[model samples]
Target chain A: MPLKLFELVGRDAARPFSPYCWRTRMALAHKGLSADTIPWRFTEKSVLVPYGSERVPVMLDGDRAVVDSWAIANHLEDAYPDRQSLFGGAGGRAMARFINSWGDIAILGGISPLVLADIPKLLDQVDADYFRTSREARFGKPLEEVMATRDQAVIGFRRSLEPLRQTLKAQPFIGGDAPDYADYIVFGGFQWARVVSPFKLLEETDSVYAWRERLLDAFDGLARKSPGFPV
Target chain B: MPLKLFELVGRDAARPFSPYCWRTRMALAHKGLSADTIPWRFTEKSVLVPYGSERVPVMLDGDRAVVDSWAIANHLEDAYPDRQSLFGGAGGRAMARFINSWGDIAILGGISPLVLADIPKLLDQVDADYFRTSREARFGKPLEEVMATRDQAVIGFRRSLEPLRQTLKAQPFIGGDAPDYADYIVFGGFQWARVVSPFKLLEETDSVYAWRERLLDAFDGLARKSPGFPV
Candidate 1:
């Protein structure tokens, strides 16, 4: 049996919109591995409970189940050593931990408010209600209110990507010459925003925009083929 | 004959506190290569003009002059391949470009406001005048004003370090298990602050603070032995 991955989607099972899940998807492709997608949704907590995870990107390889995207990436790298490395090497694997954190805090955290309101439109009624309720409880506001100032907020978000911008300017990718898990970790956030919302997270003039175009075309247009708003 | 490094120093000359210079210093020590320190000051631009650059971290190895800390690091890595690797490997080296950028923007840029006011105290009158004028011209404000709200500004600065904090929390160093050029890139900023100012940049409870302490104690307390305020 092929490996199986629980990927978070919404009304359209074909669209895996979770940033964390996209990270796993890219990692699997990078490692030349394929997994049957088990489309997940916000209200699908019961299915994940059996996998001992409350999240998408739960990768089931044989008898072992990996819960987190980071864990899944590691598992893919270690298990498929003969395949292309997700992290270039041990050092990259180490530093990628920082990149993963940056993706979560700077990318995912930064882009959340910019697109959260649009996400409900992609979800079924039950999932949409669950998402709005959970997110509102967490943020103490409605999703639309949370993302109300996204136009202005996006300027700051673009500025926050300066480090990534500078790095991309001098090199083709964060992985240097080629894309790696560091690139995937960050690109996953962009993919999430693209798939669920029509927001323009990156400007056309940005080196980040160019890098994103490269990634969108990476792995035989794997990410581009997935259902998403035009970046 | 040992290698020679043009390091930025203040009036005392013993304190080399330029963040970029400190990066070269740490990289040298990591490579287990020693260099005779040639103290340079802000007004010493003419000397560096002959070096083809106006940077303090102008490293002279044999007859060739390597300017810029990043260039010097790459030179050392390629030149001394037999010694300790500054970047773990090719991937580590590549990802480090991003870390280098984060160090510049988030580390050096964030800490500037907190410590810029105090830097004049450590510089000679000539250097101080040059420093203030150039920086004021750049920022379009008096140095004190630039740094006036540091107490409140530091809260945001600390929060901005979430990525580094998260990275250190999971691993001993960005290089993992041991320190590397990536560690030096970030630590150089702290060393610069420690040498030039008395302000506390990290809280005792912070993982970043602990990581700084470990780095300070690395290479036989190399950074600790330098003239600096208690971290």
Candidate 2:
């Protein structure tokens, strides 16, 4: 049986845009495997009840069901030992945990305010309503207001990426000579931002921008082939 | 001949306290190797001219000289392969680079304002003058002014460590169950802070505080045994 993945989508089921989901997508591609996408939406919580998860990016591999992006990545690596390794070795796996934390905070959290308001426009009416209400409650303000100063806030967002920029100065990928799960952990956020918002999160001259372009070209341009803005 | 490391010190030559040097110190101890310390002061740049570095932590192993903490760590790993691996594997070596960057910025750079002023007090008159002149020029203010609001600014420094705190929630060490070079990368900074400052950088309730305690106890209390402020 082919692997199946529950992935997040908006108005267009073809464009799966959750950063966590993107991590799994890249991992599967890196392993030279494919998963049949079970397109999911924000309001479709009941559909995921069988999978025991309230979020998308849940992976179903035969009898095993894995929830959470980090868990799913580990599952893929362990389950497919014969394929290209997700982490280079035991040390890489441990160190990548730190990177995973960084990706969550610096990459995903940092990008949220810059592109959040734009996300609602891509959702259908119900998901848009659910997303706006839930997110606004989390931020304690309207999404529009939160994103109002994104033009200026992006400078700090760019600055927050200094460690990543510094890393890329010596390496072409976070995984060293080639892209690995570490690259996917971070690219997931940039890719998600690209799918939902037209905001340019990186400067063309930045090493991070060049790294993203390389990932966009990975797996036969798998991410680039998805429907999204040119950004 | 034993390996000789030129390490930064103040009036108390026995308390070698440069963060970079501490990284190499911990790494050397991890490899179960010992190096004799050549206590160095800020004004003694001309003494290190033959080593081709303007910094401390220049390690001389027999006829070979290694400079910089990161390079020294790599040198130790490669030169002493029969010992425990500094990086778990090739992937670990690559990913650790990112952690090294974060260590330099978040751990070392983050602790600077809170502890920098305390450093000059540890130095003698000549080195103290050079430290105040150079560092004040770098910060564009007196060290006292920069550190004045640190009691409040420490909250932000603590916040910057959130990612590291998140990582420790899962693994015992950044390098996994046992401490590795990655753990040493960040611990070197905390050890540096403890050596010079009385200011508390971590809340006792925080996981990071626990992690620091564990690292200090590693290699038979190598860091804890060093002379420093109680904090």
lDDT of each: 0.92, 0.93
Tens digits of per-residue lDDT, candidate 2, B1-231, equal 899999999999999899999999999999999999999999999988998999988999999999899899999999999999999988999998899999988888899999889999999999999999999999999999999999998999999988888898899888889889999999999999999988899889999899999988888999999999875
What clash pairs does model 2 have?
A: none
DockQ of 2: 0.90
User: Which one is best on DockQ?
Assistant: 2
How many pairs collide in each candidate, listed in order? Answer: 0, 0
Name the weakest run of 10 consecutive residues (lDDT summed) in model 2 chain A.
A161-170
Identify the CAPRI category of the predicted complex in candidate 1.
high
lDDT of 2 by residue, A1-231 (tens): 999999999989999999999999999999999999999999999988988989988899999899999999899889999999999999999988999999999888999998999998989999999999999999999999999999999999899888888899888998999999999999999999999999999899989899999999999999999989997
Number of the top lDDT candidate: 2
